[model samples]
Target: MKKKSLLVYGLSAMCLSFALPGPVAAVSNESCMECHSDDSLERDASTGHLASLFVDIEKFNASVHNFDEESCVGCHNAIEELDWDSDVPHPVDMPNPDCAECHDETVPAWAGSVHAEADITCYDCHNYHAPVQLAGRQTVAMMREAVWGKCHDAGASHDWLPQKEVHFRTGQCTVCHAPEDGSHVIFRLYDVTENRFLSCNEIMTGLQISGSFMANFDTDGDGVISPAEFQDFGEKLRERRFTTDIRAELN
Candidate 1:
């Protein structure tokens, strides 16, 4: 119990730290599209991206905000229109701000939240139009999608992004975060420890033999477990005569 409490506190603190956003980056999706839609933005678009594999343009277009003016560009980062010289193009460091940027009116509940601050971004936790389930609701299909995304997005995601299933399941991604800390970018490393008062062998063996949490304490409520009863339980587990077992013996 003490161990669990500490873990909980540490996690809470960690989460509080990211509940804020760093200064919003200055990258714009609108400016780049001026040159990109020309059908010859880059020689690499064909060979460089497997965008067709992960997300379909047609399906993505169905998102509630797909056509929302700056909204779509915020999430995709890919320039739909641009006037790049092709020889010296600006880098695409920031994609769209995810759904949160465009649909602030809808999910105001999550806007000033730590999830938003951590750069969990709009699409990271939500792919609204399709089968993707929102954070708290996961169906069998959603689980499959999450696992599939785990398998693929794991390699491509930013270093700070969480693209793993275990992190998703345990809610560890937001474990230490609170919605407020994410207003700005901040990194905090925390030291954590787990309780292990009983060894695994002891837990397994005790459970295997007794089938109850009470070893001699009459924990199972059979009624009447005394000093002798406790010792008897201990000795039986230790493989010795109950009376003499507590006296100590073999090295």
Candidate 2:
């Protein structure tokens, strides 16, 4: 009888750090993309899921690091050679870099955060591969999407959160659940007549507002509201009698 070869696989897992310099880049991104771009390329994760090998090049381009525009080897530092079809087990010692390697500045904030106590990594809330510039509801949407699969099922867990269904749809989990320090309270207009929160689209349709209301708070083009701006915005809402409630946002 011929001896059979045993197959083993290594799972890559690491907490992502921000703004950290990557390892000395050596390989071309093209070489790595050549194989990684294949949709057929997949590996069985220890969690019983088949992970796809496809990486969106467009999104990668938008990524904060863009793999430092150098090589995939910057992050995956253990590959001796690329063998798309080798029976050899993946090098188990592959170095999995952390986000802290680049983003030491945010480490203190993160360390003191509630997430840190729960062992949540930067990658828990942020995407390491497709780091897009997001704002306002976009960030909230991302958090909601992540919470469903990566964290917990909103409907199935913890009394389904305060205000139940209404709150879930109105605000991001972090808006209320994140630590109170450095938090900002944002008020979304509620349509008392309709018994619903007015979406930006609805507000535009109903009131014929010319520009995005999001810009109102993000005045000065800073992408975030200061205390003074927040106060002014609240005054404007009151003047308009928009009828709103506060949603806490971590700063």
Candidate 3:
């Protein structure tokens, strides 16, 4: 019985080679390192393709998705072409992988948060396909969302940082917050906090970008965590009292 099972497994592996290629060819990411071990392609675009290159593959492969799957692309439909310059043939209007595909309950949970009801779609967090882990969360979002989402168009429902809603309706929180790279995504506000966008910190903090928050609140020109600012920072993080005062505050 053992020999027969081995034969079946071998056949399955052989078949996996076609649907998958490179380190993605074998379930072992070491195989990927054997080829992509080089870092030349690491910083190609504002989009980070090399961030997860050093991740612990054992942990990834041990997950239920790796049992018979030979490649990660089977999951992240984006970048399947292996080219960042080329337009991704990603099918959906929102190419992000839906958590509901595997964990149906994920959507409803986030919907209850300040992001969803305001229509901050899944792409704001999970990113297109790069799954992430933040504050114990397995989010697929970009590294920048940590701060941008706070004063986003969604109002003060959720804040990775803190500021005010003075320009919340204008959908312009990037004036102060800036992503590390020229372009990286973060959640930000929109139509009365009922809608949002995933954009780069650079776009939000354009060279000519100016706002009252800077002159009124920023004691330091550094543009981040100015002490004079963020009085209701709690509101920016959805960490506020949520008291009856909140009903008045939202108004």
Q: Rate the local accuracy (lDDT) of all candidates.
A: 0.45, 0.61, 0.43
Off by over 4 Å in 1: 1-55, 67-81, 88-98, 105-108, 111-119, 127-140, 143-251
For residues 39-123, could you state the per-residue lDDT of candidate 1 as single tens digits?
4343334347633213334444654445443343455555344435665454444444445445567467666675567755554
Output the lDDT of residue 212, model 1. 50
Candidate 2 all-Cα RMSD: 17.9
On TM-score, the stronger of 1 and 2 is: 2
RMSD of each: 24.7, 17.9, 19.7
* List of clashing residue pairs for candidate 2: 16-99, 17-98, 17-99, 17-100, 18-103, 19-102, 20-101, 20-102, 20-103
How many pairs of residues collide in model 2? 9
User: Candidate 2, which ten residues in sequence have the lowest lDDT sum?
Assistant: 5-14
Stretches of model 3 off by over 4 angstroms after superposition: 1-41, 44-55, 67-70, 78-95, 115-251
Model 3 Cα lDDT, one tens digit per residue, 1-251: 99999999999999998777565322334434443445442323336444432434555555445554535554444533333343532222334455566667767666676677788777555433224334422121223354345443443343553343433432333333323213323333322343333133422243223455455345566766433354433243344222211111110
Best by lDDT: 2
Q: How close is candidate 2 to the true structure, as a TM-score?
A: 0.48
